[model samples]
Target: MVPIPLASEPLRIGLLGCGQIAQAHAAALRFLADDGVARVSAVADPDPEGIRRVAGIVGDLERSYSDGRELIDDPTVDAVAVVAPTRFHRDLIAAVASAGKPLFTEKPLAPDFSTVCEIADTVRAAGIPAQVGFQSRFHPIVRQLQDWVVEGELGAPMAYTIRDDQFWPTGAVVPGHSSWRAERSQAGGGALLEHSIHSCDIACWLFGPVARVFASTRHVFGFDVEDVAAITIEHHSGVVGNLVTVFNGVRDREERRIEVFFERAAVEATTDFIIGAPEDSLLLKQDGAPAERFDVDALRRATFAADGFDPNREVFVYQYFGYAAFASALRRGLDPVPGIADAVRAHEVVEAAYQSARTKGAANVADLRSR
Candidate 1:
């Protein structure tokens, strides 16, 4: 088995956006920098305030620009992070590809299917390392669940269910809310793309490539896009799954969970990358036994037992592993986990879901596989 690569020397990371997600990425980079992982060399955002805000957190930014093109073109930058809004992802990705820099982009690849494929094609042709911000995949619980399932501890693959019902960002207030995410032309879709895309990617990662997608979405909150969606999927591994993403729920709590049922056993995981959540547990159950629960703390202890585990470690430390993983992949000249191909495939699934919502029928994932 190949060992996971670890970053060495200096990795100068260039951030392409300073929006909300950029703040999180910058925070992660700060943690990674302590371990000699990477440093934020420069940043770019259209808004002057965006750059100022992120610079406040990242600190020591060598250069700042309002246009992402100028940042990508800078010779001092080693890698790029496309944390801009989805609408700008395609062009930024193309620019980074043209510059031959490894990239890490926030999810949904783009606002539409064709552009997502186009960006992925460009990145693939560039032959540079890339990773997407499917941060949940880096969660230790998720990794353990996937490993156990693949090792047959979950028995033969049967079926799975994914749900990401969040409260905020319902888009009921459109122009009053985060405008880019509320508009169909800007966001592509609502709940499915924004909230459940993570679960969608996880489903395919744990199961197999998606074969077909059937979905129905509604503008429950009168947003320019759908606020609620129910998507059914068929996997090429002969497994079937359903994904439910309802962003308009009138509730105070957020729920993100996925359950995979196998022939003789089952595993269920909840929430996401953010560490130290109350419900962030992974449970497993066999045919006639009781369910076993696993959480971030337990996983951390077990993983570092030989290294003298420290239970009081900062939760943000675990979060930085994803950034380190991306740097390591680039350093080792390996394909990053949840890379461009994965993003493109997940984007295709979401696109097919939109098509299914329109035709009221199952749509083949292959239909949008190219453009």
Candidate 2:
């Protein structure tokens, strides 16, 4: 399908949900709107309060719907952002694709990766532009590392390690506040599926696709879901990596870090700067050589904080960059980065890890298809 010419008009974006992540999507759309790339034209949610909350940020919507299907049916919406819960993803994505509208959605695409192939087939048949919310791929630090990998500065990642040390979204979740995370039926799994999946996506990007995994998971927080998880992923490139995630930690900070050991050099990066975070740091060291360090500009999040634009971490800023990249891709008639295929690949690995944990044995990523 041909893209609507950028010179013609801005794409009208419709939001499908109004939960916490929806707020971040609305905020990011504001940045795109300012540049005439896209604008939030409609929003839909079952709860009036949710609609009201999103409307506060996206401004007066051209239309509002009690059900997301109605919004997808609205011809006025040029593209849709499916920010609904995981359980709704398979159906919502199929609906949006059936409508032939380009769409963006939060990651994991499907809960247990069961419907991924069906979703993939539907999107391929429709040929609508699609992108996933793996915003970490858009992080400046991640890009810097990727560039080095391409240039062979970090030659063929001999070993990779990613740590997603985060707070919240675990233990004693308030019933309404992302409590879906604790529900295996709703969210699919705990820390490994929800949090570590981001790092898993990074692992796939930097180290190559995961071929197999052996995992151990624990329900340390009594959430009926595993709050702690450790997984060893073997990438097809002969690079083995370890990812550890825990949601039970109470800390004053969050750290999203990656370290890659190459043939002769090592690279380190921090600052997946989600919201109201400060500067980020990156260091590269080679054997018996001086280490080089650099500071990555976190899209003026600190500047916004210093000038009082947003003093709270609730306003996510990195996603602005990710969605902006997606918007540009839409205008150019190109597939967006971290697109649906990427989501499927990441989910397949996550599913394999969970299966391995359950069976107390190794699991192949491709085995998700049979189960």
Candidate 3:
């Protein structure tokens, strides 16, 4: 019998973005710095000034680069975090794969399926660990819901409903803010690429692979791409899921919930709660009312127990766990959850959704896989 190896070495991390999401990643990396588990040894971004500013916030990054290739080629950097922009993911991931270093990257992997598939193949051939930054999956409720789905708690999910609605602030300087997003060459799609990826991937993680899809989307806000979209997905396990994404700036965000309807009953878990059900539907609820809420404190305790984290520890929240978990997986030579192939699948779905909307017909994800 072979003894299980423990992850004991500290990881040397290189960060490659200086944007808003990069700040979140840096916040997570900073927590690891405080814990002595890992450190951001180097940084890089197209904007030298932006790299310097982020380095200042992260406390003395050893090297900075205007081009990410330099940082990837740096001998001392053990792993890389590619957060530059959606368009840059494929190139950065390729560089990291060629260098044979582990990677932690932001979502959707790349803007095109062909490029995404190529990157996935390269990472697998290099045999280096690669983790995608779908950090929201670490949310306690989501974790529990996935657990329940796998454990047959919901008796095999029959349907999944996703509502993703939020008003992206106009003041923030996002890529294509003025024109980039509207251009097809820059942003793959509008809301589906920029925002729908989160909900779509979460759906894949919680339910299963989306086998086929039908969707409708349009440029409601005068953007070149759709600002709102509706999609229907058929999961491999024969489950059906419906997703609605919009930027209507509704008075409240109702689109943040993922509700799974099952044979036994239903499970509704939002970021705010681990469970929601009809009061009369289960033993966990109150009277015969149709709605009940799960407690946040209890969910935190559950997460701490499973992850070996301090229940009372105050840190960078979910992002820190994502970084730490990916680092640990890399050290063990295991591909971290949501790697390059998953990104390719995500992009396929995004493209399928866009095409279905335009053609008014169901789109097969496999058909887009060739592109």
> Each candidate's lDDT (Cα)?
0.78, 0.78, 0.72
Clashes of each: 0, 0, 3
Query: Which prediction has the highest TM-score against the true structure?
Result: 1
Off by over 4 Å in 2: 4-8, 174-176, 273-276, 298-316
Better of 2 and 3 by TM-score: 2
lDDT tens string, model 1, 1-371?
13323233568888998877788888878766765678888999888988998898887778999888889988778888989889988888888988877888888898888888788889888887889988877667767768876798657788888888766563344333456787889988888888778887888788888999899998877778777899889989899988888875455567678888888878787864466666677888888999877656778556434323344556453436667777777776678888888887787788899999999999998777543
lDDT of 2 by residue, 43-76 (tens): 9999999999889988757789989999999878
Q: Residue 328 in model 2: shift from native, Å?
A: 1.8
Clashing pairs in 2: none
**Which residue pairs come into collision in candidate 3?**
163-255, 176-180, 176-181
The TM-score, computed over Cα atoms with residue i paired to residue i, of candidate 1 is 0.91
Error of 2 at 91 (Å): 1.4
Show the lowest summed lDDT stretch of 10 residues, model 1: 1-10
What TM-score do all the candidates reach, one by one? 0.91, 0.90, 0.87
Candidate 1 wrongly placed segments (more than 4 Å): 1-8, 170-177, 249-252, 301-312, 317-319
lDDT of 1: 0.78
